[model samples]
Target: MDLRDRTHWIFDLDGTLTVAVHDFAAFKASQGLPADRDILRGLETVSAQRATEIRTALRQWEADLAHAAVPGPGVIDLLEHLRGRGRQLAVLTRNTRANALRTLRAAGLHAFFDARDVAGRDSAAPKPAPDGLFRQLALWGAHPDEAVMVGDYLFDVVAGRAAGTATVLLDTHGRHGHPDSADLVFSELSELTSRLATQPPGQSIGGPHASQKS
Candidate 1:
């Protein structure tokens, strides 16, 4: 539970590290999908040819967005603090590896992680599934208990809980829609970074359990 000493940090690339620019609604509309449908899951039910076309379009959209990627508030500082503490860092995104790398480089965060540490949809099943998180943990040689999954959405919390890792929700808007699965909630990355700088190792952030169960 001492994050400084033992924690491995697995992060969601898009909204977590970078400014939220992906308009899910727009992306869905572009694919002729319902506004509320999960893109990946929806693609699964489509014809192979159609699915390929949608994926190709989605990839192009993501590539374009990558060119405009901007770091979220405190992203650089928080990442530097964690790196200075020797925490293992990795990215588990639902994006393609190529897109993830582009965003990371564009946001100036590419140095914090190696290519192997960044797992995208092509690497494993996406968030809300434990596959990508587990895969990253395996590569890091760390157990779930020694890692924390940080993201800005419910899917991230669910995936972290499903993988038996601690979950930190970056709910910048104060929406408490998915509190049950999150071990800690912060309105800003800076809040978490500040806590890490001031709190003792193994300190609980008001969670019933310091480490979550799958």
Candidate 2:
């Protein structure tokens, strides 16, 4: 199925928009956890209190390195295209609200989104829960059938699906990833910009078979 009629665009902040210097795996190691960056899995393995502490600590570390937050490829152009088309933008990240805003400000993307449109940690149940997506959709008066979720992670896709929005996985690796049950996938965010220029909202621009190694 095509994205036909999607308007509201919910985005993920981290791997989707900005490239963070702080290694998530290293952060877990510092917290006496595994050397991997499966943060949610690690949290599930530890006590709830401990998981909260780890997340908090990691967030603080990210804040300290906020200066290292760089814009991802084609992020500016994509945002400009969306804005030009008058699409509503919202950031739904698993990061803390403060950190999300801080990164956006540092990357100069803060003006692209409104304060209310950006949902961070504690704002909802976090990705894979659909709470944040639903909350934003409700606030924007947009229905699930008229919105799209654009992110780079499985949680983002899952959350979008759960929220009843079309899913667009930003697969930077050229791998046909479908971790969150995404409806469509894009290798480059820039590609989406080009597609939006020619196609209206809701039309499927990308073909069914693109070069992605699922």
Best candidate according to TM-score: 1
lDDT of 2 at 3: 45
Question: What's the CA error at residue 79 for candidate 1, in Å?
Answer: 0.7
Candidate 2 lDDT by residue in tens digits, 1-214: 4443467899999888887365776777777886554676678888889988987787778787665687889999988887887889999988888888898999889999999899886799888899999899989999998899988878888898899888888888856445336777777877777666666665445554332222
**Which stretches in model 2 have alpha-carbon errors above 4 Å?**
1-4, 20-22, 34-37, 47-53, 200-203, 208-214
- C-alpha displacement of 113 in model 1, angstroms? 0.7
Pick the lDDT winner.
1
Q: What is the lDDT of candidate 2?
A: 0.80
RMSD of 1: 2.9
lDDT of all the models against the reference?
0.86, 0.80
Question: CA RMSD for every model?
Answer: 2.9, 3.2
